[model samples]
Target: MPDGYSTLHPAMHGMVNIGVRAARRAGEIMVRHLNRLESLEVIEKGRNEFVSAVDRLAEEAVIEVIRDHYPEHAILGEESGASGDHEYQWIIDPLDGTTNYLHGFPVYAVSIAVAQAGTLKHGVVYDPLRQEIFTASRGQGAQLDGRRIRVSKQISLRGALLATGFPYRITASRTDTYLDMLRAVLIETAGVRRLGSAALDLCYVAAGRVDGFWELGLQKWDIAAGTLIIREAGGRISDFNGTDAFIESGDLVAGTPKVYAALSKLLAPYARGL
Candidate 1:
């Protein structure tokens, strides 16, 4: 067990342990595959969306570990899709930045989250390149490699540094709206970053590396773990409509309390008819 594992709620011990182990295993597979990207097979799942052999192998590594310890638990994986329909569902994205990884851009992660009866219980986001793990269990707070972490104290958008992902996969009709929204946010904040990995982007938000993060068209596996970490770290999250429907809608806005409020207000107009 790692140093910080003991600090989480006892009820979450088993899940968190398995989550970390699975994530690490996936991370190892990702690193090993990085050196051989050219020889790996690739597939296009959608316009501007892709998957590589490494993604499947890494997800398999994660799922194998999870099934070993909790064979009956449900799982929702990026590569394999959902299996089982139990109360405890493990949502995982074994390689979050496949495009970046394919291009050797090096910003990706292994994300895993467990939800019991539809409520998030624990999460783990592991960055293989940096060898850092961000973790949280409901009501136990968030941590990075065992030390506690908190959202940034930046209360206003005026100087806040925010992160976001472009909705490349579903941008055909929403391009103008998204660009306008981006323009609004960019003009108000210090700047914005379109990092290749949404999981790492949210983890960065939880660690206060960025004051906030928002994105559209994300899958459950993309934000499940990071959302729990942000909440446990004392940050706030909501759909563009400022509701708790991000999980289903995949349109999310999150930040420290004050920043969340400010950003939500600014983005509300853009979300009016959506």
Candidate 2:
């Protein structure tokens, strides 16, 4: 299957090839460390927040394999910064939903995206516990465990299931943004879910499991790959104010064409300057 895909595309072939292998290997490292007592030993990164050694180890494990498999590809990881010299850069989030992982809530994932010359070319997001892997190449669309998937055609926010995450570390009431976002979706959508992993949330949108998503104060590593996955799966992604500055603004809104427009209008008042 890998070889078959490699022969079918050229611009993003290396990304597909390396992403699958790296995400799987990273999942292995994560699953092997699960439920172990030592893993729950966490250090405070902020008020009432913590990061376990597992997060660091997992990030290292994923980055090491990515480096070994494609020595030329640069990497920008959540736990680690950039490295390598190739034009192709891999954006990685070794452990998204860290709090959930530590609490055994089971909503974490490892995301890997490869971009060439600043544009996303391909990517993968692996949910180790469920054993589901979502992958996408720039124009090839998104897939889950090798089956193609897409965003919902839901045209109204009132009927959609929305997703979001809270941003911590820099300020108090970090959950405030999530709370506001939650309120916005709840009053209209069928439901709002804080699954704890922004990466997987985007994948869920890509797979049509969720109709839309929005968040404030997220890093590139959290949504870079997932952004491409959602976009390729027939979803629209833009800055909260409907600009193309998602990478810099750290605020993004995404959904199907119709769903996107609805969500955009709802979010417009809050994203005025950004």
Best by TM-score: 1
Name the runs in model 2 displaced over 4 angstroms: 1-12, 38-41, 170-178
Model 2 C-alpha lDDT versus the unseen true structure: 0.80
Candidate 1 lDDT tens digits, 70-120 = 999999998899999799999999999999999999799999999999999
RMSD of each: 2.3, 3.1
Worst 10 residues of 1 by lDDT: 1-10
Relative to the true structure, candidate 2 reaches a TM of 0.89
- Steric clashes per prediction: 0, 0
lDDT at position 213, candidate 1:
88
Query: Which residue pairs overlap in candidate 1's backbone?
Result: none
In model 1, the runs with Cα more than 4 Å from the true position are 1-12
Tell me the lDDT of model 2 at 177: 49
Q: Write the per-residue lDDT of candidate 2 for residues 1-274, one digit (tens) a residue.
A: 3434432334445657667666767777777778594536688876745667777787787777777777777888776788877888989888888888877788899888888999888888988888787888887888887778989989998878888776664344545545665677789889877898999999999999899988887788888889889988999999976666888667888988899899989877656643
